[model samples]
Target: MTFSIVARSGQALGIAVASKFLAVGAVVPAAEAGAGAVATQAAANLRYLPQGLALLRTGVPPADVVAGLVAADRERAHRQVGIVGPEGPGATYTGEECLDWAGGRAGDGYAIQGNILTGPEVVEAMESAWLSSPQEELDRRLLAVLAAGDAAGGDRRGRQSAALYVVSPGAGYGGGSDVACDLRVDDHPDPVGELRRLRDVHELLFGTPDPGTLLDLSGELKEEVQSLVAERGYASLDMWVGVENLENRLVSGKIDPVVLARLRDAAPDGK
Candidate 1:
């Protein structure tokens, strides 16, 4: 019915999940910055999300959290879960009653699990992608793994929805929240691909530019930037930066080379 990966990358924690069920994101994934991530599905015990994060915040190891949750549940045999914390490796569990082809794999900083998947290859491909994908952002890595699983014959029942949820301190809009990335394909025939498309849009709209990569906006370059912004219907260069949420990297009224490049890409005549 589903395939998922929960992982910890640097200061971020995230979960990526795909399912044959609609709105799987609303029920299967949860994470807290600097704490951990969890995916509870296959007769998911929603309590595992909050309780598991609470235990993780209190310094409980991921394995201990999984054990405690299963111990307390009378219907444990019907549940499947994956957990990864800010420190140490990850943990996962697939109950006996889950549909055929159900299983899981866990490794340093990540866990991959599935029920009603084609076979172990689904999780295996996810693990390979998570360990090998070159995406620096945790959410992108998670999405890569989800895409890998889908390519490896993901949910035996086919796709309906997919989601990516990631958190890091001060990573959200305006740097005021921990939700670095949260996107969902509530229903789609190619939900993982839809998720990838949305992730790209999210990056363009919300991603912060690297200070090391910024190109100075001055003299003729500044004039070019102003022209570009105005051509895009902005009243001023500053207005363009504000609308694109690039203020964090475009302060001092200087434009980022990436921003200039994006503006050029959006040129009405494709010049």
Candidate 2:
């Protein structure tokens, strides 16, 4: 019982999923920045993750990857999958044996699918949100679609877990890897809501602030920023930013006004 979206835009690729099963993220989602993404569920064949990604890496079209994967599986009739890459096209498959409300839709850069869902509206809502979301980041777009699907009557069986997985070359913490984002709500009454909350926090900690939108750190604001940093046992603002993994949000040596405000509000002693 799961719903998911696999998408590619520019150089980013990712997957967002929700389900009545536990840790659906671990079981259904897989992606590689600059290559492609895949979501395998409803009698998932775990092999599709690596194999699909491998196929994408080899420049195979997403539709071909889906065909190859389903062809290689003996139980393909029960499996559901979605795939998208940076080029060619996207594809989705819902086996004939999938539950009653099973189906999927493919678009310019995305594939939306589900099984044991409330109805076709679930995937439709997801597609609408993915297309209309104003966010430029693939992760945010994915989350928005998941939220939309949840609102549209997600898994008919009920929700237990949700996840957002993304990949981008050199986008991980400290530019050490490609795992741009990987957030999961293993078990929660409102996993989609929890996942949204985590996505916001992830952005605050890892998203790079726009230079045009950055607030200048100077005068009284600068002193306040320094005071907050020192209170946290950091010797300098840069140290605090680094320690908090705010490199992306605090690109310039100068502090971002939003960051300064958050630090002040988060001060343990309310300094």
Candidate 3:
């Protein structure tokens, strides 16, 4: 009923999951820095999240955490869990008697897990998606992998909800919302599609803006900046022109070729 990707970023960890079950996001996903990520599914016991995080807090490795959980849980054989730590420690567990189509993958900085799923192909596809993709922002890369799982016959029960969470480096709890992105699809006919829309919105606001700087300019430079801004796609060069730090550049009347290249990249395709 759940498929998730738990991953470690530069200094943070993230978890993203989707399932036909309600609140699946809450139960199947957990993450913590200095520790690792955990996904407990298939007759999941929610306590595993806190316990796993606590173990991680004590500097327990991912493999050890999985071992500890199995030893403690009376029903460990019936449970399915996957873990990946900051140091790249990884492990996967599947009870022999799990409801079929249950398994997982553990890698350098990520774990892909699912159970009572469509089939083993679901886990295979998820892992493939995760491994084949190039490194990128955890949010984008993780979601891309999840979407690929859906394309590969995700949950047999179908989709209902999903969410994504990532902590920022040096951010305290409730620290000015260091959560780079937090989104949930509580209910949707197309949760993944809605997730993509929301992620796109997130990128527009938080992703890098096109290269932009201001300078006092001569006739031609001023005209060029104005034209770029008026073209309906480029950022207004005037926005930075008067700034004290950038004043020198503006006064130069000619943009540096390197700077112009950056701006062009940002506004490529006139976007």
lDDT per residue as tens, model 3, 178-201: 566777888887787788888886
lDDT scores of the candidates, listed in order: 0.89, 0.89, 0.72
The candidates, ranked best first by TM-score, are: 2, 1, 3
- Identify the superior model by TM-score, candidate 2 or candidate 3: 2
What candidate 1 gets wrong by more than 4 Å, as runs, is 267-271
Candidate 1 per-residue lDDT, tens place, 66-120, comes to 9999999999999999999999989999999999799999988998999999999
TM-score per model over all chains: 0.92, 0.93, 0.74
What are the per-residue Cα lDDT tens digits for candidate 2 across 39-88?
99999999999999999999999999999999989899999999998876
Candidate 2 — which residues are off by over 4 angstroms?
230-234, 251-253, 269-271
Pairs of residues at least 3 apart in sequence or in different chains that clash in candidate 1: none
Clashes of 2: 0
